[model samples]
Target chain A: MAFSTTIRQAYQDELAGLRTAGLFKEERYILGPQGADIEVEFPAGADGRPVINFCANNYLGLSSHPDVVAAARRGLETHGYGLSSVRFICGTQDIHRKLEKRLTEFLETEDTLLFPSCMDANAGCFEAILGEEDVMIADRLVHASIVDGMRLCKAMRDTYKHSDMGHLRDKLIEHQDKRIRMIITDGVFSMDGDLAKLDEIVALAEEYNAMVFLDDSHASGFIGKTGRGTHEHCGVMGKIDVITTTMGKGLGGASGGCVSGRRELVEMCRQRARPYLFSNTVAPMIVAGTLKVLDLVFASTERRDRLEANTSYWRRGLTEMGLDLKQGESPIVPVMLYNAKLAQDMARDLFAEGIYVVGFFFPVVPQGAARIRTQLSAAHTQAHLDKGLAAFRKVAGKYGILGKGKREIMEMYGK
Target chain B: MPIDKQMILDYVIREYLEEDDDTEITYNTELISGGIVDSFSMVSLKRFLEKKYNIQIPDADATPEAFDTVNSIAALVERFVKA
Candidate 1:
């Protein structure tokens, strides 16, 4: 079959336009396992070097932990590799059920169902339960997966301004005529690290007779005192109707996700969610590694405590250096550089200085809101943070982006 | 209610660009193409216009040419209100 020349030309034109607009994305090659410090292979035959990584979602630094690796090895020995079938037919295993139970206990939910990725979990959840008569009012800044999921459903969709309760209340009132209403939001806004006001959302949901859904992917392993999730952080442990999150982030930095909720909702997802029904079962290695991760998280507060300490210390260090940073309690810190070109240049300079962080601009965020999002992990030591701060001061100073009298301020604060 | 261009511009500035002081947006400012307003914000803007003007904006007419600038948005509202 001959392909159409016009269609090919159209796609090529789109690619060229993207390049011209500076919106084309490129991937960096990692030479080793994911961790606080990683070896990266830069383009142009540059010698690979170890850089302090600040962009990974390995919040607790358990991605390459020894115990987790051993558990995954054990999983491979016992359960082999891929299952090659979906959960219902011949793919369900004892470990899958055990992991589900552990997740339920940890999240304080009635039931849990696993998916290949949180993207899939979000994709499958909405369409399965919501109908044309229903309405889904989401926060404007919810993750792309949730947006795509909402698009797939027949629900009358509306979005309130990000974390604006008044706007949310207005939206709820606007959609009051719908048969069923569900309020959806992310537990933590990834870019800004600001948390969803779940207590306020819950109160609004109660007043409007709406159900609440939270995707806690960014907060699952290290948000609250016990690290149970944002529900625990916001004092709404059992008030949320559904919670979906990922193993790819704070949980284990692997590939899997789940939706935990009431027994009836979970049962409905198992029966009707297309991704859960059609996709192959999650790999046994990931399941086993995640099980061990849960064990570590529950056994002690050591990692979470260290993570909190690291975040505070790093945040303080940057503030003292007079870098413009978004104020938040989450470990995801965004250093604001409003100009897109400046953000990209800063990221490149930081990379050259042995710091690995990505710049988010334009399409990722709104215009005039470009920034470099730096995440903290428990594995980052005080020395690592100090070095990273020094790099920031040097590069930002070169670009004349540092605040006035920052050097004197740093001296006053004194390392 | 009668549609007003200044009123639409005031609403956009207050709602979306209140914290932004570096750039001043006028009636002819390119919103969609310039990335000042994104798709999600467009939905909110549509709803706001619908409610305030007491008119319906079909999804098909909610394009950049119709709603990218304050002037265009006001024109769209006027068209719907007249209809």
Candidate 2:
């Protein structure tokens, strides 16, 4: 069969349109491990340079920690590399079970089951439990993976306004006739750094007899006092029906995720969740590294404290410098620069100033709410924070993006 | 009760296009194609229509052409309301 010229032309046209619209995504090459300070290579064979990283989800800074690395090395030596099987097959090692147990204790849940990644964990959960008679109501700003997961499930889907408890209550009342009503939301919305009103959600769940589900991928390692996640922060521990989170973010920055909740629900996922039943097991190295992260997180509050301090200090410095920031207590802070072009331009200027951050615009956020979402890390010291703040002030000043001048900048962008 | 185009437009403006000027949206105004109503907004709009008019918008009618403009949305709602 001949190649379809029509298909090729269609793809070419789409790619050309993306390029013209400046919506084409380009990946920057990082030459070193993920950390607060790292060398990165821009496109076009640009030379590598060290910059303060503000885009990583390494909230606890355990990504490249010496002890975590050592644990991974030991994990490789003892448990080998790949499992080459799913959990139910020959892949249920003692470490995997141990890690799941540790996660249950850390999350303060009934049980936990691991997946290859949080994406898979989210994908697997909804379909495993929800049936056609059920209803899955979600926050509009929940992660894309959750949206896709709900799509795959047979439940009738409804979404309320983001972070609006009144809208959620309305949705719950509207869907009260369903056999089971499941309310889904992100613990911390990644883009805006806003948290779900879990306290109110739990209350509404009780009023409507609905189950509350939280995907705490962004909140897992540092939101609460001991880093137990949104449940702890919201003071609703043992109330949420299900909590899904990742090791990819705060928990050592490796690749794995889990669903921790009721024992029956977890057991059902273990047996029926497609991603869990079919995909390869979590690598022993990542599991070991994550186990170490749990140990460190449980042993001491130093990292969590440093992370909280850094977040508050950075937030205050940025606000005092007159940068427009979204309100939240999460380490994920979004400096709003409404114009998409300005967001891209400011991110580029900040990169030139040796501060690495990405611009989010258009489809990632709403059309008018473009921003540079900077995530704080425990690894970012006081000096790193100061340097980053200085760079931000300088670049923001160059673009005239200060407090009173923000309106002028928006008008200049014709937004 | 008959379907109300102005009511539909007002709800869309209030919920999805809160930042947009009220005069900007009219009966024939483009919604999805004009970038005002995204996929999430479409879901919300469908639910709103279902609740208000007691009409179930099948997935087949959830296309951009079928619901892109306020006029098209009003027409779709009218069809189910009359049926």
Top-lDDT candidate index: 2
DockQ of each: 0.53, 0.46
Candidate 2 per-residue lDDT over residues A1-415, each given as its tens digit = 6659998898999999999998998888999899999999997599998899999999999999999999999999999998899889899899999999999999999999999999999999999998999999898889999988998998888887778787788888888889999999999999989888999999999999999999999999788889999999999999999999999999988899999999999988998899999999999998999999999999998998999999999999999999889999999999988899989999999999999999998888876678899999999999999999999999988887787444665786745
For model 1, what TM-score does chain A reach?
0.95
Q: Chain A TM-score of each model, in the order shown? A: 0.95, 0.98
iRMSD of all candidate structures: 2.4, 2.4
Q: List candidate 1 segments past 4 Å from native.
A: A4-9, A404-415, B1-3, B10-25, B48-56, B74-83
Q: Model 1, range A1-415, lDDT digits (tens) per residue?
A: 5569988998999999999999988778889899988988876466787899999999999999999999999999899998989999988899999999999999999999999999999999999888999999998789999989988888878877778899889889988999989999999899999999999999999999999999999999899999998999989998988999999998889899999998888888999999999999999988999999999999987888899999999899888887888888999999987777878889999999999999998788876677899999998998889999999999988877678342342343321
lDDT of 2 at B30: 73
TM-score of each: 0.92, 0.96
